[model samples]
Target: MCGTELTIEQSGIPEAIPVEFCYAGWQESLQLLALLTEPEIPDQA
Candidate 1:
């Protein structure tokens, strides 16, 4: 099995939250990689 991880901390957050974004296939994996880079995608609500 394959595994990966991405850790990040928000502006006011103290500890780095571990985001276990698992991917099923290569196409999905690529998408995850892209997301991992941009850790600052502010929510638009």
Candidate 2:
């Protein structure tokens, strides 16, 4: 079950999950990080 808000900018452009989301369960944290870094955006962009 996903219960985190992941705004584009809020995800550090696609490499970081919002710190708030990190407060959730351990699984949620991993999921959030995955979702946050899922975008194929270049690391240098």
Candidate 3:
């Protein structure tokens, strides 16, 4: 199993919110791995 944490801010809000996400099972693990390993493209502006 794998887990991730995130903090998000809402418009007009003074504080950030904490969020947690977890992935389990074989399929979910694969998906999580793909997301973590995906390549990022550079901006060519």
Candidate 4:
């Protein structure tokens, strides 16, 4: 009931896939948001 809205789309695949996902609580929702919004760090040689 309380969460953010997400839209997903995929292409170049042989079959259609399910795009919608619902989190059971705020903790799970926030965790997902953090993963998505956070930037990735590049590896150093």
Q: Which predicted model would earn the best lDDT? A: 2
CA deviation > 4 Å runs, candidate 2:
1-24, 40-45
Could you tell me which residue pairs clash in candidate 4?
none
lDDT of each: 0.55, 0.60, 0.54, 0.59
Off by over 4 Å in 3: 1-24, 42-45
Lowest-sum lDDT 10-residue window in model 1: 17-26
State the weakest 10-residue window (summed lDDT) of model 3: 17-26
Best by TM-score: 4
Residues 1-45 of candidate 2: C-alpha lDDT, one tens digit per residue:
855674443334334766655555556767778887776777885
lDDT of 1 by residue, 1-45 (tens): 646675534354334543332223444866878788656868999
Ranking by TM-score: 4, 3, 2, 1
Q: Which stretches of candidate 4 lie over 4 Å from their true place?
A: 1-24
lDDT of model 2, residue 8: 41
TM per model?
0.30, 0.31, 0.34, 0.41
Write model 4 residue lDDT over 1-45, tens digit each, in one string.
955686644455444533332223445877788899877999998
By TM-score, how accurate is candidate 3? 0.34
**Higher-lDDT candidate among 1 and 2?**
2
Decreasing lDDT order of the candidates: 2, 4, 1, 3
